[model samples]
Target: MNVLVIGGTGTTGSLLAKLLPHARVGTRKPVRDGQVRFDWDVPATFGTALDGVDRVYLIPPVGVADPAPVVESFLVRARLVRRVVLLSSSAVPESATGMGALPALVRTMPEWAVLRPSWFMQNFTGDHAVAAGVRDGEIVTATGDGRIGFVDAADIAAVAARALTDPLPHNTDHLITGPEALSYADAAAIITELTGRPVAHRSVSTEELTGRLATWLPPEFAVILAKLDEDIRGGAEDRVTSTVLDVTGRPPRSFRDFFRGFLS
Candidate 1:
């Protein structure tokens, strides 16, 4: 089946693209063979990428305040496609104003699946925070003693690939998480064990974190992140779910296993 992967170069999207080699990658910039140029910010480019595509692995652009218009527009243009598998976050509840719209749209599709995965284990090694922490031997966050069920990006991608390739129920949401919940301190300890370094997990005040993030991200995004940290600290994402095991028929990878594979 011909598939289109939005954000094909991103963390989860990259892995999904690799898993679905026959899938067409949609990006804004010029891409190599088997890849198509498509931009979420530019609605004009949606048609070329969606043409003859049977399935889509949708990823909303990062730091977007209003994703509904973009998603709705894309869906309107790509009405011919059979499936649209959306990559949503566990942080976005069905009731949240900004985050709820896409999932709502997916409900109208002929066949769709929404993946609500918890914090990715790759944030420690592949993302900005983790890379910076690895370089400086310190991981700072506003989540004080909060446990998070950090799911692997690979597992999310596996589930997405399966949902896209096989027959599945439409308009379904999967809350995927790791096998266990761990705090930042626990993650730091695991990283130290893997790399044999003195990696410290420092708990910063929400105000301090917001200030630091303001230098890089927009103020609204910074505030949202700070609130999310508070939510995590409040034990909102500490629960482990069976969705991963139910869908993949295998236990989700633990944070320790992720450390072993990625850090070692």
Candidate 2:
């Protein structure tokens, strides 16, 4: 069956695309074979991407606080598709507003699965601001000492691949995470140990972080992101789960192991 992987060039999506045998990559620009042009803001591209697609692995639009409308429109057009797997955040609960609302909508499909993954371990080594801060010798956040169960993007993709191709739909949400919970400071110490670069974690206030983030993101999105840090500071993300093992039949890689390659 043809499977469409939306946001297929992104961190988890790209990995997932490689894992699926019959995957069509949906991106804003189609530069390679099997890569179709798709834009969440441009509904005109949805039909062509959905053509002949039997299932889909969906990643919501980046920086969109509320994606239900656009996603709903796409689902309406893709009603004939057999299964839909959504990538969501652990912080967002089912039926809540914004991305949270998507899980409920996906449940309405013939077959659906939701992956509520924790913070990505890649954020510290990839193109994110945290990675930039690490390059600048520090990791700045408003999360204080609160820890997060940062899972690797590859682990998330593994679970997504299974959800998209399993003999039957999972028909449930999977709370995916790594084996351990660690604060930004813990990650920084690990990075310093690996790279010998003396990286540090700098804690800041939510207001300060929001202002700093606003330099890159929209003011409203900056507020939301800073508030998520506040949630992390409250111990919201300080937990681990075995969903990766249960779903993928292998344990999720730890943050340290995932970091060694990037930092060392």
| lDDT of model 2 at position 16 | 92
Each model's lDDT comes to 0.87, 0.92
Q: Candidate 1: where is the Cα deviation over 4 Å?
A: none
Model 2 spans with C-alpha error above 4 angstroms: none
Pairs that collide, model 2: none
How badly does each model clash, as a count of residue pairs? 0, 0
TM-score, per-candidate, Cα-based: 0.96, 0.97
What TM-score does candidate 1 get on C-alpha atoms? 0.96
lDDT of 2 by residue, 35-128 (tens): 9999999999999999999899989888988989999899999967989999999988656678778988889899999999999999988899
What does the lDDT come to for candidate 1? 0.87
Worst 10 residues of 1 by lDDT: 93-102
Q: Please give the lDDT score at residue 119 for candidate 2.
A: 97
TM-score, model 2 to reference: 0.97
